[model samples]
Target: MIPEESRFESDPEELVELPPTLPDGWEIATPDAGDRFTVARLTHLLRAHESAGRGWAGAGVDDVLLEVSEASLRTRENVVVRDPEGEIQAWGSVHDRAGGRMLFVHVVARDLDERLGRACSDVLVEWAVGQARAVGAARGLETQQIDTGAFADDERQHRWLAAQGFTMVRTWWQMSRPVAPEESELVPDPAEWDGRDVTFRLVRRTGDGMPEEQDLREVHEVLESAFTDHFNSHEETFEEFLHRLRLEPGHRWHHWWLAELTDGPEPQPVGALIGEVSPSSNGPDSSYVSYIGVLESARGRGVAKGLLHTIIADAAARGRDSVGLEVDADSPTGASELYLGLGWETRYVTQSWHRDVPVVEAD
Candidate 1:
């Protein structure tokens, strides 16, 4: 509950009213840098509760805090709801991605009565869509799209998104596999590369572990080309791609790897795999595959398999507990089959929803 005197005072245009389902004392305010810890705690609690029936893992406090910090810097709008005692009950934000052509909204709320939950989500969704429209107008674009996701088992979230005019666009599999202590044998030996003149190596870094510019550029090039035909693929600038990945917690230069083929006139960069360490809710640290791609020309040459083996072996060497990744369930490349063969199993599924916003022209 927000105090009477400390209740947020904002321009009438910016002030979003609490839904009638909520208590009269509830207040809405924009969070600042100082609210990182509180926001993270609230996010973790809400996600944990929501994930119970979905079988997906909730994010750790460190990762949530990093996300909050980055959102405060990069997003177009962010807001939070507080109870009468001033405890954060819900948080939401809208990120304008791909230069305002796409808006991604994230809303998390603590467990409450169904009516209150729906009311809280409604306010956030309305505010997020309004922000998206403003961003589209500023960019002079005719229209923009709003995107959000919900776990397959979370019917309440699905209903809220449907009521907001978002349609389910795609489904994804969240998969994970345990890292064995002696998995080095699982990695293919160098001699096994008989017919395919391919090699896998970690991205070169300086003494301080900063990636070399050339290798980093090659990584971006490979991913851009490989994902050209992928589902919902978009053209992201090299700077945006790198900056987004670097903002994640436990992102390290050493976690990036590349696969090259010497059979070409010159060494050809065929595949790239980037990983980050995540604190698991169960106990030990886990390795997450953030991005993995192989060029179309290199698909049949086992480049993708090599990159996966390299990451798995590295995680085993570092004593990480497991490796996790998400894959497009409808991918034409049959990526899920590859993970299945390597012992990865589906933990849960999530659906992506999209809504298009009409742009407002200036008078």
Candidate 2:
């Protein structure tokens, strides 16, 4: 149990409270019933409060909002907390990704009082678990940032999760590279690699409306070929990827790039780089490389480096301050080494905790 004493005497707003029962005026709702307003409120709460601000510190408000929106659209179960005035104070949602169900809890706002914090979390978890059981979900998951430095509260948070029966399973590193202000260094001069015949272009449908079937087919082939040997080499369908990306608030179509094999039978895309920028927190100031992959046939021909350079130059040209991405610490592709060689630095690390859960029996 969290200590009864308030952690912050200077600010009464900082106290966290856990309750034996729900507070008098709070109500809960499902996403289908106009829950986005609640999500927006909790998002603001998390953004404004320092303690709940770390995981998405570098992300823009618009980006996070889009994430929540996407999740709301996909998940069958979502728990929202609203004050008596019908204003959302906190929320947590579940993502039914791949074969497992992930409980994505975004602690949007917290009171200075510890009791209030505990109360909010207690309700959120209880609701999430109940929803999982109702949906025949076997497992629950959450992502919490682990601090590499002494000043962070990751230890306490981890201990709390363990107390709730979760354990650490895998880890990831937050890496970043500074974008130099001078365009002379990062951009590739056409003269330097002129004869290589290698070129990168953003993929798009020929028409202006909904994505054409051909465009999606290409996205599927490119992503599948790119991550054939990647660390978490699980197959996520094109529809899933499309839905997920479109759900992101800051998702921009042009940020996705494809390297076409100029000599190939189909002018096929052999490598791809996907990126996004936040308009809320990163303040429309920085771009983040969300994912990148190079097809097996395209691996050794400077495709990866060329794609990275292209993305970096694009972000810089767009006036981004820094570029960020995550690399598996144990990736066999030596991706971390490549990023390091290009000047990206490690900020810290985070672990992925997972446990095999027994499937719920069908009635």
Candidate 3:
């Protein structure tokens, strides 16, 4: 068995004289069949290092594991680190979507200090840069929401990320509320639609992977059309959307809803909401709204509020204590207001750190 001591060292000041390289006995294996071995080893060590990892409070190693697992399934060439004894200890992956490539990294478990962690992260960043270069991307991007409380639990992670040249480029807020019997008061009256011809519907898939292709297509179209003007809105292709969702451990076909224009002979969906349930290491249970969108024409019809309610109800039905979602504090659409009006209070502020790795200049 690989010794845990070597992987959980707390030396934040490990000298950085030599540039970071792959750990001993670790090899950068090709993509196609890397998941089985890498995921098993990484998951085991990460759970073992639960409280020992730097970012324990916010964005726990478990959270990062979920993020990386989903990312690996969406992105290609997922690079993983293995010990001399063949146990995986760290990893990161990249997904090319929305006209750009996104870099995702997470430590399985490490015996290193702040400076050393930064050095180790650099290896992954460099690899991402190279991958972006190979893909002809104009710039490379990475995202981390500071409000996730990751910084609060592990100041070293924030310091190290900033030291590595990432800059704050966006911000969001996490909000939530208890499911009360009178929660409907927070929403516009469905009865108010008596004069209007529009109707709303809660949509779900048949099974885990058996989503209605047409509904998925409609939701994607609605999302693309709706969020085009929103901050950091990127047009994710259907393939990319499917790939990302498939990566999610708790992704369910029933975890979506679509709103339609009722006047049409065939209901024309114009809005959508996507969410997922995640296992919590700290508490009983929780769910999160990953994405929510409504077409420009569908915005004022109470569709957004209705969809939120549907998602909350779904969470409650699943025995989850609370539902969580992030929204831009200054959204042009005033989304945070909608969330707040519905009794969801700000739990934490999330700042987005970004870096532009411009394409290499041609010789």
Which RMSD values do the candidates have, in order? 5.7, 9.2, 8.3
Instruction: Pull out the clashing pairs in model 1.
Output: 1-83, 1-84, 1-85, 1-86, 2-84
- Give the per-residue lDDT digits (tens) of candidate 1, residues 177-256: 99997885566532122226887887877777677989998999999999989877767777767766777777877888
> For model 3, which pairs clash?
9-111, 11-113, 12-113, 12-114, 58-149, 147-349, 147-350
lDDT per residue (tens digit) for residues 55-141 in model 3? 243333344455444344334445554456755555655555445434444443557555545655666555555555544333232
Ranking by TM-score: 1, 2, 3
Give the residue spans of candidate 3 off by over 4 A: 1-41, 44-74, 81-89, 106-111, 137-154, 180-196, 204-209, 263-266, 280-284
Misplaced by over 4 Å in model 1 are: 1-23, 52-57, 70-72, 100-105, 108-110, 188-195, 361-363
Shift in Å, residue 357, candidate 1: 1.3
Candidate 1: C-alpha lDDT: 0.73
Question: Which ten-residue region of model 2 has the weakest summed lDDT?
Answer: 6-15
Model 3 worst lDDT run, 10 consecutive residues: 1-10
lDDT (Cα) of model 2: 0.57
Q: How well does each candidate superpose onto the true structure, as a TM-score?
A: 0.87, 0.73, 0.72
The sequence of per-residue lDDT tens digits that candidate 2 reaches over residues 1-363 is 111321112111222232455568766654333355554565566555434424444333553455454343444334556667776666665554433334345353555255555566566555544444433333232322111111133554454445555556556777888776574346464112221556676666566755456655676688777776765455566765676677776688777776777775566567777788745342546677887878886778887888788777877777777788888888878888999999899876766544333334346
